[model samples]
Target: MCLKRGRTLLQYAISPAVWLGVWQLASMAVGMDLLLPSPMAVAASLWKLAGTPQFWLSALFTLGRVCQGVLGGVALGSALALLTHFTVWGERIFAPAIRVMRATPVVSFILLVYLWVDRATIPAVVAGLMVLPILWGNLTVGLESVDRQLLELARAYRFGRWKTLRLIYLPSLRTHFASGLLNAFGLAWKSGVAAEVICPPALAIGSRIQQAKVALETPELFAWTLVIVALSLGLEGILRRVVHPREERGQ
Candidate 1:
């Protein structure tokens, strides 16, 4: 077991060493920090940024926007899913519209949405738009996947709608709902931030990233990109821990 662990560690270290070697070689070949900043340069800029209050402020504000967008998307998507699941007419009403939403380009929606809403709200709208179809589609499948036998049993036992939903429907749907939320949350954050970058919302990480890009601060740009990646990964890790702790612990 110890031998296996040592081999795994060595293998992991080998990849980074190889990548760093390639990156350094490429930097030397280019001989221009403006084109592609070295890994060390990016790291140094990230370190400097980490010492600033604005870094935390921007990160927190971006997180708040992402959170708001996520909640709005989840709530709206779940409601729509339930509506379509319960009513044939509701399914007919929304099925085509949902398809259109899914097929439409993100940029098109962003541009159209910019007409009335502020830059701050644009991120939320974009996030909601991206997440809506994903959650709705997954949740519709989940609702339909409820066992007929169990539902019939509930009916036989005179279960009320609330009781039936809580006991039979919810438990059965948990996996699908959780999966949808997990998948959509990441996409929402990415699209929301992209929207914010385009819209140039004040105090947002996206705006900071845009500013870095405009100033040709490649290291700062890379640092901001790294921060986004880290935040996304961290949020995903937290969600996994909270929502699927049993499965992870078992593993």
Candidate 2:
């Protein structure tokens, strides 16, 4: 098991090393930091930024906004799924609106929402909008796909509503909900950052990214982008661990 784990870690390391080597070669050939900063230069910029209080503050604010949006979206979407699944009137009233939301471009929502909301709030609102349709669609399907036999069995056993949900519905929807949540989180994080970039919130990673770009600080831009990527990966890893702790522990 140790040998296998070591090999897996080595494989992961090799892929990044190879990509970094290619990036370094390309940067050297270009010979212009403006067009493409070297990996080392970006790393140095990241180290510098990491020492600043503003960097941590911006990351914290962005993380808070994205997480708020994700949780709100999940709650709203789950409620909508339940409503639409259980009632024809709910389906008729909300389904078309959800479809329209799903069809609309994210940039459009961000722009429209920006006009309606304060700049600082736009990121969270836009992130929720982006996540809502995805979760709603995924969970609606999950509800539809619940095993009729299991539901009937629960009814046959005279299970209460709470018992039915706890034993039958939740277990059946677990995979679908988990998948939708992870996907929604990724979308929410990205959309929130994009909204922040467009609106330029007071203290956000996206704001810093925009500042770096406006100043033509290419290395700084790369560093901020690397920070975003790292944060996204780290948060997603945490979510996965929470969602599938048994799998993570090799159970």
Candidate 3:
């Protein structure tokens, strides 16, 4: 087990090392910071940015918006899933709209939403829109796939609605719920950031990225990009730990 664990760690470390080497080589070949800033230069810019209050504020604001969108989406999606799955009328009314939302481009939503809402709210709204359909789909499938036998057993045992939900439905839907959350969070974070790039809230990572681009600050741009990547990975890792705590510990 120890050897396998060590090998896994080594593999993880080696991939990054290889990629960094390739990136450095590519930057050297380019011979232009504007076109392809070196990793070291980007790292320096990141370090500089880290010292600023604005960097922290931007990260915090963006994180809050993404989280807000994810929570809102989850709540609404769960409600709609329940409605549509249980009622013919609800399905007829809402299913097609959910499908349309799933099919629509994120940019289109951002642009259309931009006209109706405050600039700062666009990222959260877009993020919520991105998450809603995903959650609705996953939960709808979960509802459909639930073991009918267990439900019959619950009925035979005279289980109350709340009791059945707590003992049977919740456990049955755990995997689907966890996966949906993970998928929705990733989409929400990405869409929210993209929305911010398009609409540029006053204090956000995407706004900083936009500013860096407009200023032609390639190293800073790369640095900000690195920040986004790091945050995404870090947050996803945390989410994985939360959703699969037992599996994470076993690993």
Candidate 4:
């Protein structure tokens, strides 16, 4: 059984290995690490980064900003969604604004925000703005999707608004909220870090990445990118476990 499990794991790993091989070959063909680094080089750079206190500090700083932005966005988006539901005029007023935000280029927002705030806070605000529309839109749709018949039944049973919201609206909205969070979290991470790279906060992963780029440290740049991807994936995994534990238990 141990051997079989090991073999299964190896089988699962093969595809990634093959893809990495192709990437390394392409990088070698280009003969410029400045453009594209090999997997081994990135791994080595990552190992070096893992040994540094500064690396940890920078990573933590970025992580805190991302978490703060996500939490703030979720709260504001949920509140806005509820308000829009309560008043048709609110919906009409907010919908076009959300659409405009969604349509605006992220770079434009970053530049605009940079002019107003310092580097450290710009990432958080940019992340929040980027995620707000996604959460609001998805949650609004989720609330709308709640069964009208079930709502009528709740009313017939004399369920208060709060009780109905807790028992009925919440369960129905979970999946939509989950999807929104998953999408927004990744987007927020990328855009937030991009903002940071441009703004160069005192101690941020993006600042380090920007330095790496300026110094032509391709391996370190790739390593930082790998770290970002790892963190994003880790957060997503934790959210999945916490948000859908019942689904796992059922399985």
Residue lDDT tens for model 2, 1-251: 99999999999999899999999999999999999999999999999999999999999999999888888888888899889998999999999999999899889999999889899999999888878888899888888999999989988999998898889878878888888888989989999999999899999999999999999999999999998999999999999999888888994
Q: After superposition on all CA atoms, how large is the RMSD of candidate 3?
A: 1.5
Off by over 4 Å in 2: 1-5
Q: Model 4: clashing residue pairs?
A: none
Instruction: Give TM per candidate.
Output: 0.93, 0.95, 0.96, 0.94
Residue 133, model 3, lDDT: 94
Clashes of each: 0, 0, 0, 0
Q: Kindly list the per-residue Cα lDDT of model 4 for residues 164-246, writing each as its tens digit.
A: 99999999999999889888988999998999999989989999999999999999999999999999889888888887788
Mind giving the per-residue lDDT tens digits that candidate 3 earns over 106-156? Answer: 999999999999999999999899889998998899889989999999999
Q: Per TM-score, what order, best first?
A: 3, 2, 4, 1
lDDT of 1 by residue, 1-251 (tens): 99999999999899989998898889888888888889899899999999999999999988888888888888988999999889999999997899899899888888989998988888888888888899999889999999999999999999999999899989988898889888998998898889878897878899999999999999899889989999999999898877788998996
The ten-residue window of minimal lDDT in model 2 covers 164-173
- Go through the candidates in order and give the C-alpha RMSD of each one to the true structure: 1.8, 1.5, 1.5, 1.7
Candidate 4, residue 58: Cα displacement in angstroms equals 0.7
Alpha-carbon deviation at 132 in model 4, angstroms = 0.9
Candidate 2, pairs of clashing residues: none
The positional error of residue 23 in candidate 4, measured at the CA in angstroms, is 2.2
Error of 4 at 164 (Å): 1.5
